[model samples]
Target: MDLDCFKAYDIRGKVPEQLNPELAERIGRSYVEVTGARKVIVGYDIRLSSPEIAAALSEGLRTAGANVFDIGQCGTEQVYFATSHFGMDGGIMVTASHNPKDYNGMKMVGPDARPISSTNGLLAIREGCREPLGNARQPGELFQIDAMKPYIEHLLGYIDIDTLTPLNIVVNPGNGGAGEVIDALEPYLPFEFHRVHHTPDGNFPNGVPNPLLPENRTPTSMAVTASNAAMGIAWDGDFDRCFFFDEKGRFIEGYYIVGLLADQFLRKTGGGKVIHDPRLTWNTRELVQEAGGEPIESKTGHAFIKERMRDEDAIYGGEMSAHHYFRDFAYCDSGMIPWLLVAERLCQSGVSLSSLIDARIETFPASGEINRTVKDPEHILQGIERRYLEEALSVTHTDGLSMEFQRWRFNLRMSNTEPVIRLNVESRGDIELMKSFTRSLLDDIEELDGQSLRDPQLSVAL
Candidate 1:
């Protein structure tokens, strides 16, 4: 088995070649050993490889002298739900999330839905798999359970759709696992659903079901405009990330949604702390403050943000990457919660999604995030700090490298899971200045790294 399958957040790799049933079984046995859990729950997505992986993993878990309860074909969130709902010792989800169809991965959760990343215990699990557990095989009973209905009820209890007014909306499930949940909730919703590719198709004929890419969003945007809907929403493979589009079929930045959701949560929770990533908008901070809640900033990624939320006892957290974590949901990020809040807000206020987000658009102008590849990522980051951040602003190396100014801020960090460096720039409502400064910084870094734009393909990919 390839060791590269163990990633920063979870175990992921190309299916068949890098990831297969044999490897998944090893991981399952390794997880049971490292966590020392007697019983483990398992869940999977709609991907074709998921069921096989789940079965193999269960076999491995049973071999390790542990009981396995299999919740067949569910979303990643459902796996988290089962860990806490069924009172299991630990759980594992068979999914690659938003990655392409050729890839597959596993996400592990400890008791109470606590995540296990590489730095936590993933490496130990990997190393434990190296030595085989001979003659330790034990057969455990397998049973099926429907975790979806209870999970849906739990979500609806938190969001009140009855207070919403009637509106037309389009939901593009992108052929992932969200279709069933959306279908189950439609009858209770106060809106018209113009759904596209809502069926769960693991083949992903509509191009991987990732709404972040412009190409993947074309279908959702077109449906929104054609149906004359108030807005459009799309989800990733496992439905962990949700992206939005306006009435005119324009994609809204995820940063703004963060502010919108934070505002709503603060209103209901009576000014609890809200957490946000440093990438996109400071408007989230301003909104939290205005709502009488403390705002906390953290490094990007679900693991980092979730850890901070737990420490601060935050009510809500959002990242520009479209991951939203809620206090009610075990402090784990969910793609389903943000849209539910948006729908409820639209219903109660009698406002369109576009109109609700307009005020935030004017307040927080961002250049979005840009990624570039370089040989020496650290050297380029150091050069950026020396040239742009040394004299005028405060700099911190929390996740990557972040520099703050009075009116403008930017974060330049290397990817923990990949070789590329990511740059995120934001300013106080000045679009042009943000663009100009971003280009200048990119040019400076390229010159220092002695690299040039070798691939026009990168531009097309973004």
Candidate 2:
């Protein structure tokens, strides 16, 4: 087995070769051993290999003296729902998320659906997978359950049914796992959904199920425009994150969605704490403050955001990558809840989605996220820090290097999941300044790699 498959946040690697059934079973046993979980929840995405891997994991957990609550073929968040809502000791979702077809992985959570990442317990699980396991006193049980009804009920609880208005919306699951939930919730919602690539086909006829990619978004955008949709929502393979599009078929950055959602929650609760990732914070922070809510910054990633949310009792947390967390939902990120809340807010406010966040988008113009490949990402980061140290108001190494100046700020960080370094820049109401900073950062990155860093098409003007 390839030990390298064990990642810091979750286990994702090429299927069979790196994450075969045997290895998956071993991980299941290791999880039970490490978390001392008496009972666990397990689910799989629509991938062809997922069922076998999940079964192997179930075998591992069952043989290791733990009952397995199997919520068959599901999205990642469904496992979180089953684990926390049913009060399971732990949970596992066999999914590769938005990764390519060849890849498959698992995301785990402990009691209360809290993330079991590197700093918490994933490292221990990795080590435990290397050790031999003795036979258990008695094999545990496995139970099959349908989680959709309760899951849909819980999602609907986030919004008032009476407040919903009829609106045409486009939903693009990209033939992943979200279609199931959307179909389940259709009967209860007022919005007219225009679905594209809605089937749960593992073959991914339209391409990999990642809506974050520019190419993957075109179909959704076109469908929204054709259908005259008020908005559009797209999800990755395992449906852990959801992306948004506006009435004009324009893809809205998650940075602004974070701000919009923060305002929605703050207005309801009459002021509460909100958590947001550091990658794009100005809009969220400003909106939070304006809404009489406390803004808390957390390191990027679902694990960091969820833990921080629980600690701060944050009503909601958002990341620009599209992962959104709710305190009432066990402080776990959900792809389904975010769109639902946004839909409700849009319905109640009776304003175009574009109008809601347009001003904020203009006020704190961002470069979105620009990625660059480099031989050594750390060296470039160090170079940036040294160059900007004297001219900054402050510098933070929360998740990456965040340097703040009077009129502009930027965060340049190496991606944990990929070799590329990601840069996000925003200015205080200066679109030209944000663009200029983005260009300079890209040039510096290109100089380091001796190749053009900016991919013209991937770069978006906010």
Of the candidates shown, which would achieve the greatest lDDT relative to the real structure?
2
Model 1 over residues 75-94: C-alpha lDDT tens digits? Answer: 88888888888899988999
lDDT of 2 by residue, 8-84 (tens): 89999898789999998899899988899988999999988999999999999998999999999999889999998
- Alpha-carbon shift of residue 253 in model 2 (angstroms): 0.9
* Candidate 1 lDDT score relative to the true structure: 0.84
The models' CA-based lDDT, in order, is 0.84, 0.89
lDDT of 2 at 68: 95
Candidate 2's clash total is 0
**Quick one: how many clashes does candidate 1 have?**
2
- Candidate 2 worst ten-residue window by lDDT: 453-462
